[model samples]
Target: MSSNRVTPTEAWQATASRAADCALFFDFDGVLSPITDDPEASQPVPEVLEALDALSRLVRRVAIVSARPVDFLRARFGTLSEVDLFGLYGLERSHGKGETVTEPAALPWVPVVEEVASEARTALGDKAYVEFKRLSVALHWRKTPEHAAEIESWAHAEAERRGLKVQLGRKVIELKPPVDRDKGFVISEAVLSVGCAWYFGDDVSDIKAFDALRARTAVEPGFLGVCVAVASSDETGQEVSDAADFTIESPVAVGTFLADAVKILQANAAS
Candidate 1:
């Protein structure tokens, strides 16, 4: 926290030393796979898949937290005994090999989310696409950047009207049910208990997860929490980079970092 940013190698080395109590968390888009305009086309790099397969052997926990639906994530990564999937920003979760669980509190808001999704589709018309999920509705303007501001304003108005929370991400605006959960809550309450936690993320919403780790470290100063921002040197991701303890330029670098983590943990085990 004192220094600006540590090199990826330093993070990997430190993680290796704390392997017994280490947990790795990742954000899917732009962290595991390259950000694509066609979200359906996004796929994890082979190196990332290999690294995760290896980490399953080394770590106590590996959690992928994302705004994607749990079903979509399950289809992409399959079920792993050591991996937990926190989807819809933790509104929905799937434990290793278990069925996806929706928070009971979030269920009542399903109709509300559907209504908003309908409004988004009508308002944005052809300029944007509405992504309907269990507890949230997202209006994505990735393919229509010129309509970004208009779509965002409408999404915000709808969220405000419905007493929903607005989640801002890259070229997307989401209306989430007014739940007390987020990436931060999920990490603190459900995932990260006894570990030197490492989280890699690439969007604005990921700051809350980083904040959760920082709060824990503040109470127990010996706690090692590494926040890795996967972002380009571009201005768009500066906020994410600034909030993180370390930075990796792209998803490719993220794959390399994870692979390095696997090797380091494997080496430590052999020793």
Candidate 2:
């Protein structure tokens, strides 16, 4: 095991020598874009997009696993034809060519999420706000810190009533159907089907991917996996950093990391 923390530049240089054995994955919202007051309007940092485009040529597979709807992420970075997009924590998948493949069972969960969001809004009142993501719904209390406890209670109770699962993220609580899917599960499946994997993320939800990477390595010797946590000053960011194998300062750092990886891969291919 490597104990020294490598910067994005160093990490890429190391991987360039073993390009064929690596796969890169990222969490979209916080990893690629700065968290915004309005989740619906979040966009990736300019450098992040450019880096992803460059990295696409280096590794065998580069993907994004996120809680956002597939279409939403596709709209943001779909212009690049070399990256794969996985949304809803792997419940949905979109290819680089703009084609999407989704789990059939996940489709029906949409209306259930809508109903839950409506009920949550009425129950929580103005103390909390609701974000209706296409596949999931989030109740945010960042602006109303006092309502965190109340929001959590309501989310748990409401999710139970609807037979759905509630995920705690940052200062928000999300409701999604209890699917046999998660970021970790997705990463494992991707690795088995594609060789080795790397994941970058910035939230507690991403811990599932980190755990998955550890588990896979334990069972299979010589498996190449990299778990990265993008850092911020928030509690959620701290949690993710603790769970990750390495930490990067911000989204720009992530972009620089990806771009460097691409360069290494290209140089190796030419050599």
Q: Candidate 2 lDDT, tens digit per residue, 124-242?
A: 98888898876789899878989899999989988888898888888888888788888988987888755467788888889898888888888886776678888843655566777
Tens digits of per-residue lDDT, candidate 1, 42-96, equal 8887788888978977877788999998888887788466688999988888976
* Model 1 stretches astray by more than 4 angstroms: 1-6, 190-192, 232-236
Worst 10 residues of 2 by lDDT: 1-10
TM-score of each: 0.94, 0.92
Worst 10 residues of 1 by lDDT: 1-10
Clashes of 2: 0
Task: State in Å the error of residue 200, model 1.
Answer: 0.3
Best-fitting candidate, scored by lDDT = 1
Distance from true position, residue 103, model 1, in Å? 0.8
Instruction: Kindly report which residue stretches of model 2 are placed more than 4 angstroms away from their true locations once superposed.
Output: 5-10
